[model samples]
Target: MDTSLDDLDHDYAASIADRAMRAMAEQRIPPTPTNFAVWFQYFAGSHDDLRNAIDLLIDHNRPFDARINQDLFETYVAPQVSAVVVDTSERLHELMGTAKDFLATAIADNHSQIQAISDVAGQGQAGVDPKALVAQLMNELARAASRATRLEAGFAEKTRELDVIRDSLSKSEQRARTDTLTGLANRRALDEFLRKAQTTAEWGEPLSVLLLDIDHFKTFNDNFGHGVGDQVLRLMAKVLREKVREQDLSARYGGEELIAVLPDTDLAACTEIAERIRRAIAEAKITRRSTGEVLPGITVSIGVARYRVGETVTDLIERCDRALYLAKGGGRNRVVTENELDRAEAAG
Candidate 1:
């Protein structure tokens, strides 16, 4: 059964990669990383608008680059998050109203019960017939008990509705911040985390970010197919989960790109962590699933950077990315730090 499930996943991924290739060929587009990422989304039916946008761009002979790719993400994925937030907010309002209504009903019911008790007490002491007073008290008690039971039922039903709404909102929020393929935090999540981390880092602890690029990823994708390419990405995510602290976060930044956010960390510690990840990737074996054939394992280039006080999220990300570029330039499968890059240039 496991093997069958694996085959299903393998075939599914292969189909996606195959469709991506077709899209590139059909549009006469270059098989660049940006184009590949875009077409992959197109093939996956992520959004009708994404497909239409790509078609329009191709028709206009526009270049596919980071700007266009980012635009696509902003259009399709980011908006859903906002919509979900608004929808969730509205649901919360309804929940609040329900609670307020319940409170009002409870207060009114209690007041009625109090008034009934006062009337019975007055009648009993003011020379009213005993039989009449007893009957009146019994009626008031039954009314109170009936009201309480009804209110309890209403509370149960209304609270259940609120629970359902809360759950829906939670799932929507998760979807907004999660990468579909790797099940890691998405780029949006990373951006948000960086922003908050920056604030906390100013007064509390240091923050660090790492940018990782799979070495020769395009060639690997072309040779071993997208199934293996996805396998490689998932493996990277797994290592990140295994090695990083619970407080740290790992996310898929984009195609063949991953980000790690570390709180209470410095450059020295982050660099050491990056090196560990690099070495782990180098040492792990990757095998072809279908034939059980041992294939060549892949490595990654990583860049480490520390968040500076008052630095924007973009600034931190760019610094880390620059270090990653330097690592790739220094030769793939190595880790580089922002300080190291600065020192190298100064020495040169």
Candidate 2:
């Protein structure tokens, strides 16, 4: 007897699962569900990028630690996060169409009842019982009232559904734009806000960008592990949130770099704000929670650049980065501005 397709498929999947688990065991990785999924896909050779990344990690003898595992899952798996928002939006649209169709049906039903009443009122022929006509008209009105009640109930249900979906979409979009570690705006959100600010700048409004970097962030991570490093980042984000105005935006610009977008602010004001941030971070106490040890205070290097009229956002960011490079080169915890960068370049 020929083997059934279902059995063959099951056997294939079982073989892949066995291989995936064995590979994780060999690497001494924990048999977590996330790790299993990643390895299962790896063995299946479904995702090219995921497979290549795993292969590279293997070649380098990198440890499959929790952080690396989470990174792999996010880079390969959780990128479909936006798809949730899109799916929710489509569901919302479908619900609206359902509501529209329901309203149209209700309207048609009411019109038919109104026509029945008109027909009864127009009947002037003899032997037409007036009592019977009145009874029929009352029955029609009662039915119409029932229909109206049903419509109201249906609409209320749909409205509740809409509220739920709207909240979900809002949350999804927020998660997509927010950095999970620092609780600050992520790079994507920063790009969007900066582009909009650039539009405002075109009208001659003042704008400034500050790029702040935690001094010796890699050293912190290397010595204290990612947990302590994360605490330092969170501390920096908190300081930034307190220092900047409500109208401004503070975002994590990848890794240990954080940014603030200041609208209607000139170069001097931006520089002052950067100094304030530097001081605030320097004053904040950093402690390692695991060992209850008080670490040294942390400081940041800041680069400030005022937006130039007719310049692209990229240019502004690049100038700010150059100034940041100067600050880091000069010392680890100072503020530099674009004007100073120009002078430094000229002197060189």
Per TM-score, the best of the predicted structures is: 2
lDDT of 1 by residue, 18-118 (tens): 98888776654445444566666677775677779878987898865445665675675456456667877888888789889888998999999999899
TM-score versus the correct structure, for each prediction:
0.80, 0.81
For lDDT, the strongest prediction is: 2
Model 2 error, position 200 (Å): 1.9
Whole-model lDDT per candidate: 0.82, 0.85
lDDT of candidate 2 over 160-230, digit per residue (tens): 99998989878888987787777888777888999999999999999999999999876777787666777
lDDT of 1 at 122: 91
Candidate 2: residue 328 Cα off by (Å) = 1.6
Candidate 2 Cα outliers beyond 4 Å, as residue runs: 1-46, 53-78, 124-127
